[model samples]
Target: MSDQIKFIVDSLNKEPFKKNYNLITFDSLGPMQLLQVLNDVLAEIDPKQDVDIREEMPEQTAKRMLNLLGILKYKPPGNATDMSTFRQGLVIGSKPVIYPVLHWLLQKSNELKKRAYLARFLIKLEVPSEFLQDETVADTNKQDISAMEEEKDQLMKRVERLKKRVETVQNHQRMLKIARQLRVEKEREEFLAQQKQEQKNQVSTESLYSGSQK
Candidate 1:
């Protein structure tokens, strides 16, 4: 049992509580309140263990220890193993800040290995409906943000494609304008050459008539 408890403690200590900053804040349990809960649980387990809960245990460690106690059916000195008494003790023994932490732990414990025992022990627990609702809202907001980011990326890609297409069209129009100017210049040159040929033909005819008359 001690080995199992030590393993559980080690596992709990290694959890990424700092990464779940929002969830921790949502629970709102202060350090001192968490310490008291840890001390109580530790005392229940072994009064002679000689470890100071406040000095040695971190908040995450305490929360995990409490979870283990609930799972292993470690009833306190005078309380029954039922959910109501357990919840009342958590609320009354600790400060108001402990409620959120307690709720969070209970919610998480339901998915743990010894969940059947925990479920039975905490069957009568009344989780705050608002907490669950707030968590859902948080999740939905994250999804919305992700979707908006995806849409923004797609819009940027489309804008880039349109820019390339517009540039291509402008290049085509410029080529056509240059072609038109060249065609007009060629037509003007052809007309001038025809006029010069006509003038030369008239001069030759006048000269030939004069020679025949002489």
Candidate 2:
């Protein structure tokens, strides 16, 4: 079985005195916590193996390890796997600062091949507070989201304004068309009236000439 799966099973079994965990939320576990757990497990299974965590581990994985260290209220027993150590299983109950690193690590683990660490270390995953928020990262993401929303709003307003301008131009063209039609009708009527008047005047002059001749 995968070491990650094994860690999940081990973590789920930490009941009675610890918080009840339904599943291993690896994404929420920061790199440091992951490293510590792995170290503990590695020592148990392969204590003789000499692995340099910083060298062998990727940058993100190492960053996650450092981030998790910020949250440990009390260090787990120097050698954590010894059942006789008699210390509380948990090192810290809450860690809001490392939450983002945990989230990022979990989400990108597959892409980063974080599971490769499994070959070098063994771990027992732990559950901490669910609602812990990394203020720095959360704030950064919030600002990014807000900026994108504002940009979208501005683009929509520009589109609406352009639409209105197009409609206004169309209205002007329609008005010009109507005016041209009216002018053409008026000119036709005037031409017809002038022709009729000229015909009457010609008939009157011809009649007068005929009378004079008679």
Q: What are the per-residue Cα lDDT tens digits for candidate 1 across 81-184?
A: 33344444443444433443333443344343344333433423333333223333234334545666677679899999987886778577788789999999
- Note the residue pairs that clash in candidate 1: none
Clashes of each: 0, 5
After superposition, which runs of candidate 1 have C-alpha atoms over 4 Å from their true positions? 1-170
lDDT of model 2, residue 10: 48
RMSD in angstroms between candidate 1 and the native structure over all alpha carbons: 29.0
Worst 10 residues of 1 by lDDT: 123-132
For model 2, how does the per-residue alpha-carbon lDDT over 1-214 read when each residue is reduced to its tens digit? 2444444544434532132433356445654554454443322333432254545434333233322322221122233343122111222312332232333333343443333333223222221222113333234334545666677679899999987886778577788789999999999999999999999999999999999999
- Per-residue lDDT, model 1, residue 49, is 27
lDDT on C-alpha atoms for all candidate structures: 0.48, 0.43
Best by TM-score: 2
Backbone clashes in model 2, listed as residue pairs: 27-106, 31-64, 31-65, 32-64, 32-65
